[model samples]
Target chain A: MSAGLSIAREEWRLWARSRVVLLAGVIVAVLLVVTSALTALRVADEAEARAARQASAEATFLAQPDRHPHRMVHYGHYAFRTPPPLAAFDPGVDAVTGQSIFLEGHRQNTAMFADARAGADLGGFAGLTPANIYQLLLPLLLIIIGHGVLLRERESGTLAVLLAQGQSALTLAGGKALALAGVVGAFLLPVTALAAYGAARGEPALTAALMVAGYGLYLAVWAALILAVSLWVRQRSVALGVLIFVWLLTALVVPRLGINAGSAAIDAPGKIESDLVMLAEQRKLGDGHNAADPAFAALQKQVLEQYGAEKVEELPMNWRGVVAGYSEKKLTDLMNQYAEKRMAQEAEQSRIVTLFGFASPTLAVGAASRTLAGTDLATHHRFLREAEALRFDFVQGLNDLHATKLTFADDAKRSADPEAEKRTRVNAAAWRLLDDFRFVPDPAAARAARAALPLAMLLGWLVLLGGAIVAGARRLRP
Target chain B: MIPALEARSLSLVRDGTTVLEDVSFTVAPGEIYALLGGNGAGKSTTLLTFLGFLAPSCGSVLVNGRAVAEDVDGARSAIAYLPEAASLYGHLDAYENLGYFLDLAARKVSRAAMDEALDQVALPREARGRRMQSYSKGMRQKTAIALALLRDTPILLLDEPTSGLDPVAIDEFHDMLKGLADAGRSVLMVTHDVYGACQVADRVGLLRGGRLVGSFEAAAGERIDTETVHAAFAAREAA
Candidate 1:
């Protein structure tokens, strides 16, 4: 153990003295941190702008004059996106997913204006996150630093001397691994600091901890594998080349293969198709303009009977308001069902993706990060659900006000008489009664639970690589 | 008494091809034994077998009565190997590389002792502090000898140690080997230069067809000539 520590210390001293190693490590750390912090700020600004637009849309909806509740249902309401507070750590698929969802009486609208899969064909490769640094590029750097550990000694004819000195192959390997892990730790420190910073700001502490743990485990695999390959090869050049190949295959090749395979397995319906389907479904429900239809006429008769009215004018409630309330209820239910189905399809797609986390810890961590941040597909779906709920409440409230305040005769005649229509406008007090959209993210406890599986996989990797250390050490003995 | 280094009927087959077969030789303490052969004569192969770098397909290599392949570290600890071109970490200065090898060899000599070892090999004091990447061939060879001295092993194996040295350095290297022998160490040297072998070796062995086909002992009034040695090497090749 003392020998191992001494060797570890020696490696660190060498690295410190070697300008190239120190420069490479520092440059990568600085670049990743700066890029991550800047990107986080940019995303936060975008989210704020989106929220402001939502506020303006809500204000516009409230400014409307009094009208039949059914007409107000046709006018609809816009729901703005509420960005997750922890999204600065990892945006997940938030950029790729739609933010705002327009909810109306009859048709469901898929969230639109997502930035994912945007730009030219090659643009999608560089996802917006510090994860790429940890996942793809970091291993390559480890390979560069670690591949020559044993082979160089052999090439220089120093292995015999080292062996003669009571240094077992296991000891040498242990020392090298210790050295590499130290370098990997230095590389991860800055990113972990960023994550911890987010965690410090009331970001889910457990999720942040898990993220750090997962990344560390993943990089450990690289370090051990690098040493293993270096020991297995006869020449230092071959060792370096072989390790680079392994890194490329595992980090870049396999992940893209997994993502493409998942997409091929279950392709979600395109947005255009979803919109057309929602439209077709809405037409099947009773249209508000078709008052001659039996369903509409029956609804009107029911309202009169329920109020115990002798005639339309004798009724305290406006007939137009009653028509609008009934219209809003039917269409809102239709839109909600459509939404539920689309969200289900998206859930299916994401479920397939999450299963692949086992094959690649990167996928697992990516999923867990997004889920914890409330920036994953599920969160987007929830936001849409809440937005639709608010839309329903707003449209329905207007319908109820028309039914109670305006007489049936007054509502029916107001559409034809501009003067009466102007007088029928509801007071500002009524508009104030409409609720504003509020987002309640899934609880932090639930996020930690959601991240548990990936965290466990990451832990499993750490244990497995630790085992590799023992196994590789045994093989190195003369 | 056990030979300082010995191999009997040793064979090395790599990738289904026999590179060496039925190779046998022995070196006793206080003797400089030379292994002479043409290109591809397996001189380096025979030396590597003693170090256990290549496993023998048949028979065995023994260092001080222990099979080296079975006790690699033990055998390696007892010997120093200087390969052709002598690859020291080019990024490390001569002194640093020497320090590293000595450390590996389990020797804990002081920094001053390391400097003295380099001085014994006639290395320039100024060059000791510069990285080896800038060293000339003679400087590199001297540093390798300096490493061997610092290791203080009982046996030494040199593969073309004087290949690129100047006449002065080559003479100096042979004297160093002779001095090592006088101190009761054994040295096995492989070289293509027959004249140098005759000058430095107490006994010269001719390797042809992966076997030691001829050997001559050094004695008073019996100095081996280059022509006779070359003729013997060619005859072994023809046979």
Candidate 2:
């Protein structure tokens, strides 16, 4: 242990003396801090934009002229999903999912316009949060530094002298790993502070801690792999090439393949197909336009009988309000069922992709980061579900007020007379009863549990790294 | 007493090519043995196998009576090797490079001891503080010598130790080798410079076809001239 520590210290001494290593490490750390600040700013901006939109929507809804409840049902409400606080750390799939969704009685629209990948190189480069830096950028830098550790000794013919002087293979490997670990730690500092910040703010501290652990293990894996290759390959060039190839495979190729496989396995309906299908289902269930439609007419008859009225004019209640409420119920059910089916498809796709997590921990980590930040597909789905439920409640509440309060003859004549329609409008009393949109973050424990799979893969990588150390040690004899 | 370094029928085969075959020799304490050979004559190969950098196909290499490949560190600690070009980390100064190698060697000597060792190699005080990349060939060679001395191992291996040096530097290098041997250390070096070998070696061996074909003692009695040594080397190359 002492020997390993000493060797590690020596590595630091050498690393410090090497301007390139020092520069690279400093550049990485600076980039992390700058990116963290930028990500926080971006998330804050997004929150503000969404908040303003939500306020404007509420104001617009309140400013509407008095009208029959059924006419108001078609006006709909717009809700924008505000990102959770921890999202500033990871911002996961938030960009890919839409931000605002338009919801109305008898119709559902998908959340639109939130994808992060919509822009050019600037957008791609803009997503360099601390976690992204650790996952993709840090390993490659480590590869450049660590791949030549022992190979340089051999090249210079000093390795033999070092061995002659009683440096054990285990000590050598351990020391080199220790030295590289320091570099890795330096790179992780910004993210670690960010994690601590999240914890202080009462976000998922445990999840943040797990992220740090995962990243450390990931970097350690690279260090070990580099050393192993350095020992296995005789020349400096060969060792470097092998390490670069491994980095490419793990960081870029595997994740892309995993995503492609995911899409192939569980194909979700395109937005257009989902919209068309929902429209078709809506027509099938009930349409207020077709009075001859059995489902619609039956609903009308049932309401009339309940009110003890043989004809629509004789009823004190508004018939149009009753019919509108019934149609809204049928359409809401259909949309919910379709949305659930689509979510299930997406879930299946995600499950298939996560199967590749063991091969590439970055994908697993990326997903976990997004999930913890409440910006993943699941979070988006939750927001959509909550917003749709709220829309149903608000529209239904208005319909109920219209049915029992307004006279059927008055509501029918309101359609022809502007002043009568104004009289038929439900007052602000109904609007005040409906709730505002609220976004809930995923629980801390749940985030940790969700991150478990990636953590396991990181552990697996640790084992593999340990194996490489042993194997490399064995090969070091000659 | 056991030889400081020995190869008993040591051989090496790589990718179906015989790089070294049945090479046997020894350098006892207070002795200098120069190995002379043509290009690809397996001189460097023999040294690497002894250092446990290359695994021998047959027989064994013993440093201080222990097989090198069997106990890599034990064998390595018993010897210091100087490659032909003596490449050091270009980014590090002489002192820094030496410090790093000493650490790798697991030596606990202080900075003063390292400087003392550099002084023994006759390296100029100014050169020791300069980056090795900016060093001249002779200066780099001097640093390699200083490193071997700092290691203070029983045996020293050199591949063409005098390949690139001025006459003054070459003479100084020979004097250092002699001094090391006089201090009861064994020196096994590969060189074609018959005159330089004669200056430092107690004996010399000729390598041909991956085999040590001839061995010559360099004592005052029966001492050979540069002409005879050159002819013998030429004959071996032709053969």
The superposed Cα distance between candidate 1 and the true structure at residue A187, in angstroms, equals 2.3
lDDT of each: 0.74, 0.77
lDDT of 1 by residue, A1-478 (tens): 2556656666676677778777778768776876577557656666776767767766776776755445555666567666665566566666777677776654566676576532332464324457667766778777777777777777765555455344777778888888888987887786678678777766667766766766777788778777777676678888887877766665666677777776788776755676677787667666655444466766767766888876656666665666666776787777667667767877887777777666666666677777767788877877877877777777677678877866655556676998777666666556665565667777778877877776676667666766776676666522
TM-score of 2: 0.90
Q: What's the C-alpha lDDT at position A234 in model 2?
A: 89
TM per prediction: 0.84, 0.90
**After superposing candidate 2, which stretches have Cα over 4 Å from the reference?**
A22-34, A63-67, A113-134, A288-293, A300-320, A407-409, A416-423, B54-56, B67-72, B221-224
- After superposing all C-alphas onto the true structure, candidate 2 shows an RMSD in angstroms of 3.3
Assign candidate 1 its CAPRI class: acceptable
- Calculate the i-RMS of every candidate, to one decimal place: 4.0, 3.3
Give DockQ: model 1. Answer: 0.24
Off by over 4 Å in 1: A1-30, A58-82, A102-113, A116-129, A140-167, A232-256, A288-292, A296-329, A353-365, A403-409, A417-424, A433-445, A448-478, B102-107, B220-227
